[model samples]
Target: MPNHQLLNNMTHHDVKIITDYSTDYGDNISTVMTFPTEFGDIQKEYPIFFRKYPDSEEFQAVVMLGLFQNDNLFLQAGNWQANYIPGAITRGPFAIGFQDQSADGGSEKAPVVHIDMDHPRVNTEKGHPVFLEHGGNSPYLEHISNIFTHMMDGIEVGKTMFAAFKQFDLIEPIELEVTLEGDQVHKLHGNYTVSQTKLNELSAENLQALHRAGFLEAAYLVRSSLSNIQKLVNWQNQKMQQQVTSA
Candidate 1:
């Protein structure tokens, strides 16, 4: 169940409205809203995923929006974060990604974010899987729609959107053994591949290892992305303020 407090006070058009709802290709339920936007804004309302994942550590998701610099519309593919390469595996804007563990490789050695690397496919070969992996269902449409509706209220005008996605059930990895053309072999197991046995066992060393590996990086990424998003909001607010003052 989603936390309704997160969706309170959200509205579109300033009038009572009903929005179209749909889940992500992964079948993960999410709420979406499209609202009017100023000329330079990142288009209309916004979509927010409001699933409260049971496991805090395993899987997470987020929604971000704002007027980006460089005169570019940053969406699903081709965005700063997409190409940033958080170690390996390029990502695309607007799409959710997964980094899971391999069957043979223990969680520590190779924490892989699963996606078909660039090839002839959808949206500039951005490395997103063509179809939702077995277990990943597009979030429910109602979830997407409601979040979008609430986002307008939840998020201040002109701020880059950022939310940490989490739900063990929502993003469980589907095991698969894949072989590529060059006899290359690949396998997928579970996202958040880092073993949590230590956290469960309360092993100090394991907890330390999690912090050292990508755990800390994950925390930093969330924080940094949010910080940058705030800048976008500030920029939007400043512009609006200037317009108001001049008018």
Candidate 2:
């Protein structure tokens, strides 16, 4: 469970967060939730896929980092090798939370920044400070705020994008069979990817709608990102070779 608390300068004035990526810091993720807004940069490094949400059964976009769970190949000697890290990963222990507010004779929920008190990155001794010595938000905190805003907007856009894809029947299951060194076989299931066939078959009107909504390019980006799977395989093979040589 996450011990999330509303971030406040007074209570967390001295809080510092680890900004580096490492397995020790719990960055060894197989996939990270991504949104359409990030597809351009994420597609440059990771294979984009869709998975059903456990509770809502809604499709959500993600960028695969490794072939299996807890197998982030991008982490090297406590450094993330990728040129662009997903905003979900870069946000670290901070997240957007909601607070009830009364506005204009009505009640509404407002987004607030929350921090995980138990995350490994949360500390007082080292890393980037959340607040300045004079009780103001630090540059790091400002960056986190910006990330939160973008993430929130991206989430709304992602929902519309996925809905459009589903309506057009453009998503299909992705199956992968991999043979590692020593004939170790791995089978992956339950992930979905954009269907090039279905996309190509769409009518001109639908294509124009998708183009107007800015989803046509995103679909192509997702399709092109599938090539990154080969990159992942090479990384895995390299690791296996190193292990065999060391042994």
Candidate 3:
């Protein structure tokens, strides 16, 4: 369970967060959740795909980080090897929580930042400080706050986008088979992608509706991001070759 505490500069004065990537910090996943709000930047490097739960038909977007399980090709020596790190990865232990902070005897849900004290990144010494020595927001802290805002707003955006996807019957199952060096093949299942066929077959009125709602470009972005799957395959091949050379 996350021991979430409402972040206040007074109570948590010396909180520091380790921003390095490691398996212990839970960065070894092959995929990280992406948002429609981030599709443009995320699509530039990671291949965006959608997935549904075993019993749930609702689809969520994720960006592929590797060909196989727990293999994040973008992870290097304690650093991520990409210019644009997904907000989910960078947000670390921070979360946004809503509370009624109306001192005037009214009800208004206000978003406040919460910190998970149990997370490995939280430490008293050695890392990026959440607050400066004079009790002001550090650049890193400000950036994380912005990330939380984006992620929170993305919830409704994603919900409506996926609902539109279902309305247009644009999502279809996808099995990505990556052929690496020496005939090594990795098959990724339980993933879905936007169907170009379905997109093309949609009525002009439906296309206009999607376009007006700003979901059409997002759908195309998900499809266009598939091009980066080859990049993951190439990284896997390089890793395999390095293993062979070492052996």
Candidate 4:
């Protein structure tokens, strides 16, 4: 259970967070929600996919970090091997929370930073300080602020992008089957991807529409990112080999 509280310089003047990536900190996720805003950055390092919730017909973009649950292939020896860490992963224990505030004679939801006091990273001991000596944001806190901004922006853009993809009928269920070392077979289900055929088959007007909206390239990125799945297989092979040697 997360103990969330609005971040206050006075109340959390001594809050610090460990800047480490490891399973001990619950970084062993195989997949995470990504955004079209980050498609360029994410597609280069991780294979991107889409999935629809059981109760919702809307699609969401996701990036693959490993093959299955509890397996983060990028996590290695207390460090994340990937060059671009997902904002969700690096956000640590901070999140954007909304609070009602009066503005222009009307109340509205205002964005405020919230901290998870019970997160494993949170501490009063050594780590990146959340605030400066007295009562100001530290360099680390400033970086986290930037992350929330991009995350929020990404989410907004993603909604439009996914709507466009659905409008164009480009999202399709993917049948991904892989045979790893030692004849180990794995199949991924219930995930979606941008269909190259459908994307290419679109009318010129639709193509131009997607181009103007800046989503055509994002669709291509999702299609091209599948190549990274091979990299995952190779990494899994090496991990299995290491285990065999140590055994």
Candidate 5:
């Protein structure tokens, strides 16, 4: 239900985008789509996991933000508590679109920036402006462009990493059960993570290939991020205690 259009200074000269993090702006989510290229930074604050794409059978990496759907623990009083927000989450209301381009007597598609006019972040009078008064790209828009470029590159690297993971059977399903305050139980299922055992058993030639492709470090980053799951549990407990005290 998004009203997407090619971003142009002429048409959206006065538009501003909300850069603040809050649930009101749709930041309340349990996970955000992530990529292998970002696994190193993402692992520092979030637990990395894989889930099947809803429309496709392919697996995609995600940075878990909360234990339950629609619950983002990092959103505290309209601010993001983490040092690094996932690039996927930071690029709000903007996406890379392909447009036809004439080249060498033939037409090909080129990536372009598209903005969702209907998104909550889109406003005419508040937050960061997308264009300057002179109808040029604003500094915020330039930052978004860089983010989109990195996202595109990350997508390609992620494809290669996931393909290698599938080929080596290094993915394994994980089920997490947590007992919260008042003995409330929460269960998460159907998620996947890197299998260190399988990774260690890979042939030397395959290991070398992974190392050459830079997936070896990415695999370990994914493995290391699982430790943050306990951090998430601790956060939940603290939130629950605060709720009880306030009540």
Candidate 6:
């Protein structure tokens, strides 16, 4: 059975540190998040997978972005070349994913997050737009609006942007404006603070922003892993066919 610790940890805290390994991915928790059944007797395991990049060397630095459309979640994650443009924003990737659970878990329920897919530029350079390169499948257009497609499509060439959660330097604990929407709307979720003291702290005001950015990157990584695994499965089948034919 797949471990649920990581997912459990993710659910408990809005932000947590994670390390990825090819063979043994390390997450702080040991349980995955689960949803109760209608009978309230069983829980379903949520699927979790990491993104695989065409260039293995760039996986660590790159992020994956995703969006949901027609009940299927679409995703693409990548970064720009070092020499692409002048004064480019050294930003994290964009990612898209979906969660059915909501605060109320009833009518008027919405996904946990509402992606700003229509934004002209997010985390990237001022004029840059997010997009996937020519490959396996075209990205789902539901999350992003048509108004910005032209600008985004142009920047998407050779660049795949994923969602990200940015790391920040924290000096002191701060009050973060957390948007809590599911079951209850709490203007202030909790005391905003980071216990990691070894690092020089960023201003408290920037903590929430960093957390949001970092989350985006994390989502991208997850999406990339899923696609990478799918590709690997396909490659294996093809290789097996070729060998059989030769024999």
Q: Each candidate's lDDT (Cα)?
A: 0.29, 0.91, 0.90, 0.91, 0.91, 0.26
TM-score of 4: 0.97
Expressed as tens digits, the lDDT of each residue in 119-204 for candidate 6 is 22322333322333432111322223332332234234212322222234221223323222233322321122223442225455
Q: Among all windows of ten consecutive residues in candidate 2, which has the lowest summed lDDT?
A: 176-185
RMSD of each: 22.0, 1.2, 1.9, 1.1, 1.4, 23.9
lDDT of 5 by residue, 131-238 (tens): 999998999999999998888898988888889888889899988898988889999997999998999899999999888878889899999998999888888999
Report the CA-based lDDT of candidate 5 relative to the real structure: 0.91
- For every model shown, what is its TM-score relative to the native structure? 0.25, 0.96, 0.92, 0.97, 0.95, 0.18
- Stretches of candidate 4 exceeding 4 Å from the true structure: 103-105
- Per-residue lDDT of 36 in model 6: 11
Q: For residue 6, give model 3's deviation from the true position in Å.
A: 2.1
lDDT of 5 at 216: 88
Clashes of each: 39, 0, 0, 0, 0, 47
Query: Which model, 3 or 4, shows the larger lDDT?
Result: 4
Q: Report lDDT (Cα) of residue 219, candidate 1.
A: 31
lDDT at 218 for candidate 1? 37
TM-score leader: 4
Model 6 TM-score is 0.18
Please list the residue runs of candidate 2 whose C-alpha ends up more than 4 Å from where it truly belongs after superposition: none
Clashing pairs in 2: none
Number of clashes found in candidate 2: 0
User: Where in model 3 is the C-alpha error above 4 Å?
Assistant: 102-106
Point out where model 5 deviates above 4 Å: none
